[model samples]
Target: MSLFSQAFRPVGSTRADPVLVALWVALILVAVIWIAPFVFIVFTSLKTNTAVMGETAFALPTDPAFSNYAKAWARGNFSVTAFNGVLITFVKVPLGVFLSAMAAYALARVPMRGRRVLFLLCVFGTMIPFQVMLAPIFKQVNAFGLINSYPGIVLPYLAFGVPYQVFILYGFFSAVPKELSEAARIDGASHFTIFRRIFLPVSLPALSALFVLDFVATWNEFAMALVILQDPQKWTLPLGLMAFQSQFQRDYGQLNAAIVMTVLPAAIVYLMFQRYFVAGLTTGAVKE
Candidate 1:
């Protein structure tokens, strides 16, 4: 224990060292529980298919088989699927962010009669089960002749994505200081210019956080892509990964390798934006 901490602590109270030691032990245990599955996935990916399917599912294989990753990559057509996933995430995330930010700002800040009612209506849509909307959504997309097209797929993701994005950002925007907006107005900056320059710039950390989440959601989305994308060329990694499982003869090693490959991009993306998840309490921020 540090001398300062010991001096300050009361005699009857537990020492900070024992408490800290116990807390670290608990955290390490939880971390191990969380990471064990991923560790097993990597271990199994490196095992041969026969070894993976053997009696000892949990036991590490006798020899590592790194070649399984190559086989999975080739057989899964991972290159094309990964490219498609990247393209989809790239298009959907920025578009969703802009649309949601503008809409949320308008809802939160724009003065209009019945604005509360409209905001409530928008929030109500999020409560409606997505499965219930699927039929009508599909019909509308079909009527528009967008089925089997990228727009067909991307638009629905935007539709679903925007509601939740707005829900979060509206709360954030409402919490913004009104004085800044008023000041910008006095400076002759139009609402659009102020939103683009002043309000949005201050939202960097939140925006970065939202982008990573949306990008990962778009990248990993499976059920929607399965229905919308019938063309083999347009198939995303998630759908293609499904194909890998079905087409292969229950090759668990290859499946594990593909699973690992499929997860890498989203993991990297989250790590990049994870900084924003930390809350900061800087001085000079207003209550409203």
Candidate 2:
């Protein structure tokens, strides 16, 4: 049943579902709690250093000196960080999603000779933690002298994100009705065309969700970026933001301001894709 009743279906005519309302309230409350830190960060970011540390950490700033944002941009080099982040996200998301979708489509739909083995391989690939494998991967990159470079960062992002991406896409594609795919085949569409026209467009919502997820994950990724990227010039925002902490007993105001700056792009992206994000998650939740 639809969460909301249709106009034809009289208002308050469906099940009185008090439990659902209660659940909704609970979820909203939880979301508020989760988002509180962000709110605090934003509030502090708009305050001056004196205000942030003064008797106003939790209270509103007297002047609300929003220039802290510009200070953060200038001091933390968040522009460069955001630029690098965008570069990595653009390169990784499409490539990751496409590769994963293709892999998933084949595993789920095709009757290949070794299809079961391939599925098992994909599952096994996701089982190993990236940290365990990081040393060897870094060694290989070092051998290629890709350390501290864009490719060094990007290659690992793709490699790590691929397994989960494939897993999700595989399930989604498998849930597609075979009859529709067969009709496309009978209509003389090639496999590529069928997938491109039929499946890809239908899965737009899920793709949007994946894009937001992959972008955020790649953007905020700190561990690998820290280990692989050694040059201060190439440091991503997560690492760059850390510099504010270690210098002179920590400037919480600038740190918070830098954090707010770092968060803006991802927040803007999420807002833009929110419609798709909700649809994607809900649709992806639907069982076969």
Candidate 3:
């Protein structure tokens, strides 16, 4: 019998394996535990403030207040904030990934003195805490007259984001076979051409994974945005959510609705890139 069949079969008689049954039960319990809070949030978003205060936390809403979303959207000024969030995330994430990919390619493939040192420096950057650089970064940005603008937030995002992206892309790029580049070089392909035509096309899995991760990080980033974007018009989703909570602190339904809206984009991006994400992380792990 196949291993799958044997696993499901009785151990020695008519009864199923107790160990397998226990494992399955444990998995189900863990799944429920993880999902319970999200379920509560969704249910609460559909409830009125009166209903929320009067009813049990887990009880289904007797009268769902779908207008909560509309109210939250208007009161929170989400239209402006959501646009700002999308603009920053979409611009920063892809540009950062592309720049990191190029740096990784140079580190992995180019024959240069001190390449190892440079790569190590980039890796070391990832170890430093953002909190440590906050004051210095703010001063520099202000000196450059970038505060209260898109570039103010984006420049820092790119700077901080590139190190981790380079670390990930470097591993994947190193795993690529040298033969492909060698063959292209023999055909008179320039280094840039080889990278654009061959390396980039093959590195989609890693790139997509990075895109999703960076998208989520940039989308939800609040501290840097708060520090740099002084204008309420330039606020991102996270900032908008905080403002929404403060203004509607007593309105549980509208607050939860705003929370759900803020979370939805990142969740959608993850689901879209879910297939490549796992493969990308594992691809270079056991390189030959």
Candidate 4:
């Protein structure tokens, strides 16, 4: 059953609450509102430019133009940009998650000195906005001779991705039973072994959630990528898509098609990992 059905379904003699039903209706309405733009964009993308301009903005195309995607890809240089996005996201997400998990595990489970300070530093990082550091980061990347390179864009992602990830994983780690770690230690397991064998298996949901979240965030991030990557060949999808617009005229069809292409990967990633995303969010939210 759907979430709304499951939420409202009466278990026995009692009818569903009127308020609950009202809330459900409101939720559905809100969802429709939220998704309307995407639906319009998809339909508009399939239409010819002349049809889009001449016809009612939301009307269905008389003849669909599937070639819009190919035209967008060619004009936007998305073949290169998409590959860059994939490479950066793939490289950054796993490394950031692993390192963040290690840091979280240490803060949550280990009796190491200054753990509190380190954890506090991580927390502080999460509070700071990325835009505040953008100029400095760009200069640092340039200083390190990483400008317009994969590593230039990727390094900042790793740095910025970690604190938030650590914040998420720390809650999950802290929820783990201390006895499990103690038992592993008694079995002559090192900290690495305990983390590898004990915490990791139990944290799959959170990991998968972070994987999806990080993939989407990294894939969509525009400002940082724009600054660090100066070359058109190194541009990510968002920058590539912006190429569809010039000062005088915008190719709405091509622009919309590029938007759809950019949205597809993140949608696919979320769908693949969605089973874990909800559970992960709720599981570590309350300490038992």
Q: Considering lDDT, where higher is better, how would the candidates rank from best to worst?
A: 3, 4, 1, 2
Positional deviation of 120 in candidate 2, in angstroms?
1.2
**Per-residue lDDT value at 92 in model 2:** 82
Stretches of candidate 2 exceeding 4 Å from the true structure: 1-21, 284-288
lDDT of 1 by residue, 1-288 (tens): 365456545578755556655666688799999999998988888887778877365687779888889999999898988888988889999999999999888888888888788778778867877667777878898899998888998999998888888887788888888999989899998889989987798776677778988888899998788777888888999999988988884787888999999999899988877776433222124553
Number of the predicted model whose TM-score against the real structure is largest = 4
What C-alpha lDDT values do all the predictions have? 0.83, 0.80, 0.91, 0.87
Task: Show the colliding residue pairs in model 4.
Answer: none
Clashing residue pairs, backbone N/CA/C < 3 A, model 3: none
TM-score of each: 0.86, 0.88, 0.92, 0.94
Q: Evaluate model 3: give its lDDT.
A: 0.91
Question: Could you tell me the TM-score of candidate 3?
Answer: 0.92
Query: Which tens-of-lDDT digit does each residue in 28-60 have in candidate 3?
Result: 799999989888999999999889999998999
Model 1 per-residue lDDT at 59: 82
Candidate that scores best on lDDT: 3
Instruction: Output the lDDT of residue 89, model 3.
Output: 91
- True-vs-predicted CA distance for residue 179, candidate 1, Å: 0.8
Superior by TM-score: candidate 3 or candidate 4: 4
Give the 10-residue window scoring lowest on summed lDDT in candidate 2.
1-10
